[model samples]
Target: MTTATATTQAPAPAGAAAGGNTLAGTRTLIRFNLRRDRVRLPVWILALFLGTLATAGNYKELYADPKDRAGVVETMDSPAGLAMSGPRHYLDDYNFGSMLGHQMLGFMAVLVGLMSVLIITRHTRTEEETNRAELVRSTVVGRHAHLAAALCVAVLANLVLALLLAFGLSGMGIDGIDLSGSLLYGFDHAAVGIVFAAVAAITAQITAHSRGASGMALAVIGVAYVLRAAGDVGSNGALSWLSPIGWVQRTYVYVDNRWWPLLLCLALAVLCAAAGFVLSTRRDVGAGLRATRLGRPVASDALGRPFGFALRLHRGMLIGFGAGLFLMGVMYGSILGDAEDMLQDIDEIQEALQEIGGATIAESFASMVMVIITVVAVVYVVMAALRPRAEETSGRAEPLLATGLSRTRWVGSHLAVAMTGGTVLLLLAGLGFGISGAASTGDSGLFLKLVGAALAYAPALWVTVGVAVVFFGWFPRASAAAWIVPVYAFVVGYLGQILQFPDWMNNLSPLGHVPQLPAADLSWTPLVLLTLIAAALVWLGLEGFRRRDLETN
Candidate 1:
């Protein structure tokens, strides 16, 4: 009895085990992240507002007449237009404001969603991948707190965008444009942005890698757009009801002005955020609910050659991009195929058609579609060219360079795939668009016309690649320089139509000078100029890379 029993002790509580979780510390981290992104975030918000204001100005000028408005409504009411553009109800006054709203609102929503996706993924999956999450978790921060902080920042950014859009549009002298309604429209879009951000957050919790999380979120955005489009075109308004984008569109600003739809968007956003938070708590640090399985320890035959290894690494992205472009091509072609029939009922539309048409309606549509396809093609090329920088920053390129492979061969292999793959992707997108347009028109020759138009964009696309390569080689610290090249092109090409930018500024974009194929006659001088520029830039980049130290971080 006197013999002391072995002393039993209880384990310390997890509050004492790891550390106590603190909401205040997490809030401080949020502020730190916000401070780090001060310049970038403000610029993005300003851009969003400026884009909306510019659209308002452009629409006011383009559709100043009632006849013009009516014609637009009639054409938009068609199945194809409805699928591509959304319902045509607000086209009645040809309320130029509403027209701009209809044509550009979806894109704005997507842009905001993209911004959200990138921000959330960067803070969540990216931080986890870099091992920063473990360090943060060692403090008093809760498992779900990081996500909450990230979401808080996203919501704040979106709210600023909404306010700016409302303020900007109000200054444009748009008639009967209710400030409350417009703000609601912006808010509705912001809600969609928040929901997608939440979706991205949830994806990060369920996927261990940043790429998978970002891809998953983007796929959802794409699916939502498709579903909403299909539902709108099919006359089954019910289907549109199922999409968050549909909720934003259904708000019907300057028309029915149904504010209730916005409430639905807010609800969805909240629910998604709640679910994401729950998921974050259930998962462990640096691990996802859907764990990333290990690949084969041994290399496959596909990984045998330098080129083959490049292909293997990029195959998934390439296939995904091609498929997306193919689908977009088909949808665009199908929509434009019906444009002629849709416009026949409206005199103003007929006049507009005459303004835009060539020898035939098919040719005119082909020209417009080609311009779109070319822009998308250039985007793909830019993305491809930037892959070298991504590889270097990710540390994948170092090992490859450490081997017998020379820097020229290593960089050249990636560049070769980028150049070749970009061309193939553009061709496929063009062919898909052309074939679909031809099938709708019941004409076999239309394929050649469409494909040619698509190919016409190659020079401009090459210029974008060259710009990226130059940045990658000369300014390794500024990986984002490549992004600016395309952004400058986009601003010059599209912003001119919306805002009254200077002539010299517009001429800066290669697309601005590229002859509008199938509409305008092709000119060789501009093409030659673009080719020379691309070649010069590539040479400069190569020389810079050869002389510079191989960047390790």
Candidate 2:
């Protein structure tokens, strides 16, 4: 027997000490990622800035008088208002600056959290899944370098967003909003962003899949928001202390302007980064703390039928969506129960509604809440339709197509699930809102009225789904266009309310056409017209899908 000499493979160089990779190299990677996301990142920042400015402008206009401000404070101090927003301390000022501390703060926190999660996940797990991380790791870079760089990018983005918001709000003529307070507020918001980015970084290190990492990070954000909301509503400062959101809110800029809470945020961020770096050292390249197990080689009986398979794939998500919508609806509806009490104390609020094209206080409040729910429904629809795109990109579509399933049948299965599921979710939300509102008002008729009003927004929601379908079929490469379409609708619908834009401009949003419940006479004509438009768009999308090449990439 001839003995074969085995040549041992060489090990990779240790490369400059761990976490000591060339900063310039990491910076280069960061710049490249920024370049790729130039349009998107800037647009997000601009949107946030614009949103803040718009809110500042509206608050200035609505609470111009002391009586108006006092009324707002009284109403906001109520249980319903407290549940919906933060404490009403600044409401006493009746100035745009005061309102910013309450209204804009929560929204800014959410924006920061969202930007951090998206940015970190994009750089960490997303890059790894696309094999970009492997190519970069082959260089002399350390394992933690990418994460460090991504965190740096996220921090910079937060800084820029904070500065933009401060400038935007100041430009809107907000009074008594000193630069010091504004800067502190902005820094606190940015600090929260960094902390969440660290959280995402840690999640990415522990999860084997990008989806898992993204989901984990988002779940944390949701939890933080919920904790803060509960604490704020219940006046339990202890619970607030448990949440980063609460920490940021406690900053109370323009009111107390406490700086200590921000230090907590910074400490938590540093600790999370340290933990992530230590964990990274223990894991091999291209792997996570938990390894993913291979799925079954054969399809289960539940996945045998096209519709069954679609349902199986989407059941968890559908249920979650329905529950969330229902809860939101109930929350909003419950708040509206106090509208009578709220309006009784705030004549200015009522007058402002009448001036803004609303016929009654109830109608105006219902319209505002309905518009918000409609936007949420649009989001559900968009996410639903994007499921097919996700399956395609994840390579899961290939196996399903490899079976005897025809392309149209496979596509239709998912699309049917999305449309039907979205409709059901919206209806559930409407029912929840309507029932809660009716219960609170001791008026059974209000239930059906609110449901009808919510249903009226359905055609617009379907239109968004139709847009996603069209993009999925024809512009597969630009399927992100689907996300942009609904975002545009959202901007159009809400920005007008925030900025007090002209009627003609507001009319551009489809949801704007829906009659304000309890305020305007319900008309079938506009609803029918919207339905027809939705049908046309759906048909166009299907036609495009049929003509285009079946894309899996």
Candidate 3:
């Protein structure tokens, strides 16, 4: 007892840094991440840059009138404005480019942030979940290197995105854009992205699985948007400070061109990433700070069945999608009241919709929003339909198939969930929109009209399901390629109306064929024919699933 000297060993190098250089392989990993994201990063950057450029270029023409400028101010100050665009930071004068920043900056920041989150998660938590992290770690890879690599790639992407925005805005030769202001605006978007990339890095360390990490990161994004919306509309400018998107707006790009906010973003990003590095060293490979909870030791009888198991697998995703869509619906619905009133100032947007869609301007606008919602719902269903392929490739379906359960029943159970879950989610979104619309107008009768409009797209959604089912059954490896269908439909259906594409190209979209309901006449011909086509595709897909061997990775 007397000889017991308290020998406190030097505190182990605070976590993963225990391995001397925690970022030993960070540069290498960054190179790999860049290669992996070459296609994806460019696509995201171009989509946002081009969209922002196009919108900005149009502002001079779109709102040249003094009255139109005032209308833009009014629209920005409206509740719908609060919900759609964060806040009007540039209310001093008609700084058209600055006004454009207020309208599009908040949402674009969100998109950029989401891209950051996905990029980080794909390289970090997703790799860990797939055991790829362990494989990498087995070599001389540093503990903090993966995260550092992910962040580096996201940062590079953000820088490129900023340059693209700056160059695009500056090159437009628009009088509204000042070089300094354009640079600020572009960098502001990049700042927002890097901050969220840091947030994703931290989030990736919290959950054991990529899905949970993604969900948490996404939840943060949603909460940020809502918070920003609340602060902007409720006259609580202080509240806006709480949100990342709000922070982006606070940058005051194109207005005073504030540089201070970028510093704040940088600080937060650095802090979060440092914390993530700490977290990386503390946890074991494949484990999280918030570890996955243990499941019941015993299985219920329902777990033994196919449909029950399928439902069990998909319930979380369906709930998440439903909730997100419902929120989207509420936001969209809140703005419909302003559709007719606001456009008196700038009716060209209205005229364009009415011209392209052959419907009343107000009704066409509402229909457009409704159809977009349906397309999102279709995306959910298509993903759901491909679950069997995911399960099969993951080796989870092998056991299920080993039992007496036929492949048809096993696969069909996922299809069943796709159908039911898709319908429920679509209806939920519709209900949210309808209820919000009615409440806003004090005309509770609008509930049915909006809900019916949403449900009307069910056949269109099923068409996507049919196509995805065919891909899953026939070309399981290329099932993810099915996402192109809805995305293509949405782009063609929505953008085509703006670009005034040929009717043939527009009609190619299944969603385009659906009558714009609640404002336009409903026809049974397209619905019936689309449903029939869906049924045939579903049969073919299932038949292909029957004939093919399991295409497990």
Candidate 4:
């Protein structure tokens, strides 16, 4: 029996199987996330690839002449250019395709970072916060599945973007398309997105709430972007290389095309994701690594009021957005002197600016800046107006309504804050720009000029607020869809100009109807009409909200 006995291997323990089941439900969760983002992801992916194609195609025509190319190279290397588009050492070689890639590399990275943040927040903390995770977790789902699925979708989106960029650039028929450089360029963008996805994942674990996680992650991005801009514009390049944005730039795709630096992003992403997974395992469900502290025991009298409560909830986000716009104003103001000189000799650039906004360069600059600022306000207004939906979904609205508060009064309170906040944010942006402009020019009049210009966008802001209110009233389940209004405005205002789309297409933006102030006359007719229309929409919304039941989902 001993001689006939065969050696047998020990079976693995059941605990080992359980330990390996952390990703058990990842595929199902991924499908769920994808379904939720079906429209959103494709819209964004299409925009990314289309923007890349447009940039590649347009630059060939925009910089066909060597003289024009030289101007681009010179302007891009200058402080303003460096700040706007980081030092694209690739432009030193004067390849139009490379310059095109340089133009959008950082901005595109930012867009993807935002996308990643929103996606992760939607899945992880949001699910847990809303108790959807509880039901899902009660099943055969794994603990790590949600975060892993979100990351997987983001990575997939990035991969698609990279492939699109590579293919789009290759087929554009531009000279020196350099497939290696183009593909590497695409890879660089993907790397930046992956790093930010990891960053969002880690942030999602550290804060107990989704809003806190989003705010913290966005703050980090803001700081990193500023740091990169500082380094790019600084005399020494040391600070530039420290930023992830700068590292992406340092790759100098299409110039040296060196890929060694990309390893930095990869390493950071791996470490961040690993840290997030480890932290997630350590924390309890629906909780964070850091426990939240209790608020003050006594509430202020003002906090009892609806407007005050709305203000309190939104104040921090308002401050964050205001600070960012102010910094942007400062950057734009700093560049005015150089922008004038840089575009002075280029007839095409001057013509484009004139067609884009005002008769004079200063007026055009102010109008364009306000147009962008107005888009920011649009987002703020929409988010503010939809706050009540968040409350309703979270069951907080039930208590408030139970207190005998009228639906109209409650909804009106939120709208009031939203409309007022949008106005205040615009003022802050205007003041920031005006003060910066005045400082740059040593003229007090510029402040009034810029401030007035920003105010002209008020009607546009009101319309966005109205749109959000309408959604909140009738389609509370889809109130967040109101954000698409700003997306449309942003695309039309910026991308429409680049692609030189038809006038009818460009005029679709509410900002488009506002007369180019300071450069062109400010007409009262459109403003009055727009305001009336916005008021009508609000009236309709209030009536609907008053009649409908509070959204439970």
Candidate 5:
């Protein structure tokens, strides 16, 4: 009987169970990510889609005559216009399809790329930072599951956005915007997104923090844009081929309807994603391939102070945004000298500029550019304002709260940074714009005027930060809604006149209340009022944060 007993076999370890299947839990993660992004995905998709539709519809209204289109085409053919929009070849056809492809596609693709980068970083590195990925991995998850899932989510988002644009744009019954060209345009956005998603996937593996990963990926986008701009503006069209952004633009979607450039995008995406997977395998969980630098063994005096500590945490992002704003200012200012000349031929644009009330077309353009510059600075403000919430949710706030640090002090430190840092960013942008504008226009007075124009929006910027603070204090989960302020401001304040939107709609944004400076008489009343409103909002937020229970992981 003892001899007849069978030998028992033990099951393999959980890790061993998956064997070489590094992407074992990908499907589950994709579903989980999709569920988490339901609201976010729709908002991004709808905003982009509606904005495109509105812009496309207006093209017809704005340029009904062939001469109008041809005149605009001449403007676009210039180096300044080519750098801002696309290549000179886009002017060949200049149909609604070509117009849409030239003007909107590159900008739309960059936004989509940003969307994709955020999606990947949020799902991959962000999860790791929060320790959520570790908890998931302790189960049946595989090593590459998170990365694969993130890529899948990004792909899905791009695909959906592409499909929506394709069908929606074609269905509008606009001439020259055929389904084929629309599809090409839509997929061009998706291609850029996918390429950047791969870039983010690699960046995530390199950096320890999600923000760093995002920054690295965004920097790539910036480089691509710069390269594209330089190439398009220069005599060498081949230089444009070097960048992924330039690659998509070269597709000549509406003109030639070429589809080959997508192959390059696909190749790069595959290569980058594969590298990310290999890198993931080389590193430990919750750690980056590049080790974090060793800090001073002893705590510094600044570390003891809440404001200093908060600044330390925000230093990288602040510097990055500051540099970016300055460069953007310079770029915009570079074209300032020719702005009046470019618009001189376009009667519709001239009339619109007249309505905006500038002393000159250059001045009016500078005023509008100021609004755009401020809107960008608002991005930094919102991020800085929301930093405290991130700290609170991450459980770091608990240790500090247990000490002598009060909630108000802790939160105030970051708010101070948000407010002051935003002002600094605006000042830097103003200086850069002024320097470049003066050089471009060869008018020294224009420099100070542009700088003043940039600073004029500071009150509106603070108000934007205040909205984020209010959301962070009372509705932490919905803090992202604060972004609507800037986005709305950009749309209504920048394009509202052109789109013929009602004044009431424009007034809905704080930026709308701002006097278009340099172009119009600067009024102190609205600025003062906006400042008071911002102060009140901040106080309300601090009170709410003080009263409510802190969120903890």
Candidate 6:
């Protein structure tokens, strides 16, 4: 009996146990986050890296002569060029390195920042929305562990990308692109990405939904870009200093190789991250600082219908994308009036314009801009079409389906919105482009021409949405694969012209089949064929979804 006596120990109080463990499981979470993003991280990093290399190679080949390089300075010195590219100061040096810094750095930095924002939103707010963060926190995980892991993973991804960019450019052996300049260029991208990651962390605390968090962060990036663009085009360069994107652009990689601007980026990152940590302490697990908009006390009659419900869900996206595409069209059109004077001296561009078979340089440029606008509209199509899959995975679809709502009608509602909404987006874009082109060139005919050119791609856009439907119906888990349609289209439609890819390569994309309107002829044959293909794909997807099981969480 005496030997059987044993001592029992009580566990420590939770408050005491978690006092100094705000980041207790950070390392484990970081490793887990890395594993989750393994494939995605590599794809983003590789695409950006390869694209940079290809662009650099193209520039080198295009401007092999110093005199030809000087012609580029003339185009880039203008206000439109400054707004689209970077500061005009790069024109003073006008060499290979300066060209890259002036034209590529700001654009690449924005992409890098977008990458960071998505990474943070996916790992932090997305997990919380899905209720995974609640489970993670019930264990040894700390309040800040999830955000910390997200930030660490973003930092790691950016660092790897920066290293690759630095070493790869230095190894290219370009005349003016030396190691020091390359290092500055690479690290500047990393700094911009880090700052955005911190911004996302703070935004994640504000919105309970992942989409809201990512949207807020992306809006910040867009504002920064606008500020930088406006400031760069202004007489005095002081306004540029207000933007993080401009901060990195100010590094002036090959021109001045200034390192001080990087310090500003780093300081902002630290301050934002600190604020995020403080905010996390104030919010509860699986909850946002700002509560989600409360639903109506009673459901409306419209909410009962599939189409109405789908419209409600997609309303925000439609408004945001419509406004964005319209603005983008205006921006691209503003540059069209100068296409002849700007591109005539650049032999490669002239060759590309000729390849498009335009009667005039401006028409060829309009055709090129149409490709960009159509591709951007396709982004909206894919996202809207894939909304059903997101709902299913989030457990919302199961409840709606448990009622009398048929699966076909439910899915069809979303697809309808996606298809019709995309067409409307194109219409807005065309109208904006036409208005701007007519104003800029003082020719009302140019407005109608550009509008028709933009609308000509609508059939291609339908095909894109059809592709997304097929994936979502048959391979719900692999629905994201549909993005390849738009991505490939962009590569073929835009870069294919620049890199001189074979016609066969371009023809592989549905977009390639459409006539380059206002540049060449407007042929209805491809449009008819494309419309038939789109209908067939949509019908097949609906049938497949009817036969398949619901993919509810």
Report the poorest 10 consecutive residues by lDDT, candidate 6: 11-20
Candidate 1 lDDT tens digits, 92-144: 54565567667777767778888899889988888888678778766566666
Per residue, candidate 4 scores C-alpha lDDT tens digits across 327-432 of 7777777665556655665565566577866645766666666677778888888888888888888888998999878888888888888888888888888888
> Which window of ten consecutive residues has the lowest lDDT sum in model 2?
15-24
Give lDDT tens digits, candidate 5, residues 1-553: 3567688987655642256677788899999999999999999889998989988998887787888888788767877789889988889889998999899877887899899999999999999999988888877878888999999999999999999999999999988899999999899989999999999999999988999999999989988888898999999777789899999999998899999999999999999999999998888888999989999898899988999999998998999899989988998888888887666766666776888887778888888778889988988899999998888888888999999999889999999998899999989999999998889889899988888888888888888878898999899988888988888888887787655679999888888888887888889999999999999999999988988998888
Which parts of model 6 are misplaced by more than 4 Å? Answer: 1-19
The residue-level lDDT of candidate 6 at 323 comes to: 84
Q: TM-score, each model?
A: 0.88, 0.87, 0.91, 0.92, 0.96, 0.96
Across 1-553, the per-residue lDDT of candidate 2 in tens digits comes to 9999999986556444344653436777788778877987887778777767766666766666767667667777866676566654555554556577776676578677878888888888877876678777777776667888888889888999888766655555567676767777678778889989999989988876676776778778877877777777775456767889888878888777788999999999999988888887778666889877787999788688888888877776677678778988887888776776666644445554564455445656877777777777777678778778878776778887788887678777877787788778778988999888888777788788788877777776776777788888778878777776556666666555554567886666677776766557788888788778877777777777768765643
Residue 125, candidate 1: alpha-carbon lDDT = 88
Pairs of residues clashing in candidate 4: none
Among all windows of ten consecutive residues in candidate 4, which has the lowest summed lDDT?
A: 11-20
Tens-place lDDT per residue, model 3, 210-329, is 767877888888888888888887766877888878887887777777788788888988998898888877788889998667878987877878888889888878988999899988
Residue 352 local lDDT, model 1: 43
Count clashing residue pairs in model 3. Answer: 1
Cα deviation of 415, candidate 3, in Å? 2.5
RMSD of each: 4.1, 4.3, 5.0, 4.9, 1.8, 2.1
TM-score of 1: 0.88
Scored against the true structure, residue 317 in model 1 reaches a CA lDDT of 62
Please identify model 4 stretches exceeding 4 Å from their true place: 1-20, 345-349, 355-359, 441-443, 477-481, 495-507
**What are the per-residue Cα lDDT tens digits for candidate 6 across 285-383?**
778899768889988998878988898889878987898889888887787788887777778778889989887788899898899899989999999
Better of 1 and 6 by lDDT: 6
Model 3 C-alpha RMSD to native: 5.0
